[model samples]
Target: MKLKNQHIEEFLQSGLLDRYVIGDTSDTENTMVEDMINQHSEVQLAYDKLQEELFLYANTNAITPPDYLKEQVLNKVTPRKELEPEYSKHENWLSIAAVIVALLALSGLGYLYQQNTGLKQEIVETTTQFENLERDYELNDTQKRILEMRLAFIEAGDTEKYLMRGYIEEEPLRVIAYYNQPAGKAQIEIAALPELEKGLDYQLWADVDGEMVSLAVLNDLKPKTISAEILKKASDLNITIEKAGGSKHASVENLVSSIPLNTIP
Candidate 1:
């Protein structure tokens, strides 16, 4: 029911309306036109005008006769000598009308050709737009599903949250940890952490009992979410700036942030 001017114009320019009015279109086309006429006011108005014109033309009750009948009638009306001038005048005017009709036919063909090309181009453009929209919709749908999963994990009854405030940054920076004991999964969320300098690596470590265990390397921590495997005996978490790959043990002098995790579910 929602139609644009261009869409309506395509059908009108295709000469389908004339065919529908004269019962010349195929069954499918007739069905389409008839449906539009019922649903679309523009198509209905066009069909009505065409029907009016057809009716008026039929009701005129006068038409051009055959050439043989016209010749017989003209021959009876004039003398043989005077009729030459009349015939000459008739022939001249008839030739001009024929040329005009030919030109009109050629112009009509050209117009139809242009309309067909425009419609094809519009169809191609519309198809491309639809594909792009579908792709974007799929991408957004995937992101939405991921966010929903993260939400469910955070809201789970067996999840514990830990927030670590960094003292190294002038601006306030924080890291959030979500540990789910039942699922044995740990997720890290960095907030307001600036870009790391080249060659500097931020390594994460889990302090179990008194021994430090390597957990993950927090490289380029730019306020993004990351997941780490929770150590079975780890009681605390910490981050330290180390070499590019990471360090075997926690560098307490390079520590930026630390959090105790004894209350995790």
Candidate 2:
């Protein structure tokens, strides 16, 4: 009973309404027709108009055609020749033009796709090159820092020294002290240093005459010269391995090297 636009068009074209209007219907059929009419106002209107036209044609009995007139009409009706469908020259040309246009469009799209792919690859390569350059720059910066630290150590003037006694399972201590007098700075550069355990750091101490002074903390054992201002006048130097950042007093037992400034040039 429910119909869409397509269903309505199909029913109209099939002439089903003419058959239904002329037939006697049961209660179920009457109910179905009523439901359809209620659901679609357009369908109800079309059905009413068709019924009116059929009723008028069926009831008009006085204006009948004569037998001779009917015969003459039947004689005048002739069979029509079927037309054979053929494509024109212009139609053939148009079809070829359409195919050519489609092929050109597809070729253009493919070219654009390849160009885009190439551009993306180029961008990726360029980005990788930039990353490599950045890594190189970082390495160079680290090297520059190390060189600057070395230069600062060599330029120190004020000097101090302390004695670091060796502990059990470790070798005897040996280290030299150098100070920059003008800058009131001191550095403890170690030689013949022992290998340090992991997570431990070497700490320098300045022995000013007899008093002990913390100088610098060192993690690298690459013959580095640590530079820092002397807190007091000193006479001896000491080098001890302790926890990172060093301690208030030397982990005396972990001493790696110790020497007096009087022995150095």
Candidate 3:
């Protein structure tokens, strides 16, 4: 199994298992974890143990003190004979100590409550920040990869580059394309685009002779590396506004721009 004792320890210590129990994991991960529990005896045992601990914690009674705690409290509250010993000379002192302990316990509980609330808020803020950082990192990494591919395509010395105009011009589109038909690769650099309305997106089409073939429908039009196969049979490239995903046929009336692919530079 990929999971081991260290994994269990981490889950137990880092509170991941608590998140899992509460359905905080993503759907993909939740499904995978359930599968592991079903497939692996070790995983099942660990998971069961966690569940049992939670069940005991939730159902345990509040009024009854444990024997050690009961003994400690009784020691403080019990009245001793006055002439017994110097140790037993505490008449009002034990009572005072008991009250002080109770007050301190209550104060500690309040302090802990405030601390827990503060920690929860910090956790939420940290989670959101982490998600944003992760997204930015992914976008930057993807852009870097696209740029590298574009450079390689250019260096290969066989390309048909086009300006495509209109800030890439697909009716709310923005892309700078490096198309290499021989290598079957297309690299696009996205600059800017008008914000798309809900349920609408920009689509790219390859115009082959007279037929328009659906190439790609872009919603998150990040710099992309696309297959050049679509361009191989294409004599022209066209961009248009389309429904969110794509259409079987091109929306020519909605065409924002067209670039001839084979024009000699």
Best by lDDT: 1
Worst 10 residues of 3 by lDDT: 57-66
Output the TM-score of candidate 2. 0.43
List model 1 lDDT by residue over 171-231, tens digit each: 6657778877678677877765645667777777888778878767776454344344545
Clashing pairs in model 3, backbone N/Cα/C closer than 3 A: none
Rank by lDDT, highest first: 1, 3, 2
In model 1, the runs with Cα more than 4 Å from the true position are 1-115, 208-212, 219-229, 243-250, 263-265
Q: 1 or 3, which is superior by TM-score?
A: 1
RMSD of each: 17.7, 24.3, 25.1
Runs off by more than 4 Å, candidate 2: 1-107, 113-117, 120-124, 127-178, 183-194, 222-227, 262-265
Per-residue lDDT tens digits for candidate 3, residues 121-148, read: 9999999999999999999999899678
lDDT of 2 by residue, 30-58 (tens): 45655666677766887789667754643
TM-score of each: 0.51, 0.43, 0.47
lDDT-superior candidate, 1 or 2: 1
Root-mean-square deviation of Cα positions for candidate 2 versus the true structure, in angstroms? 24.3
* Clash totals, every prediction: 0, 16, 0
Candidate 1 positional error at 43, Å: 43
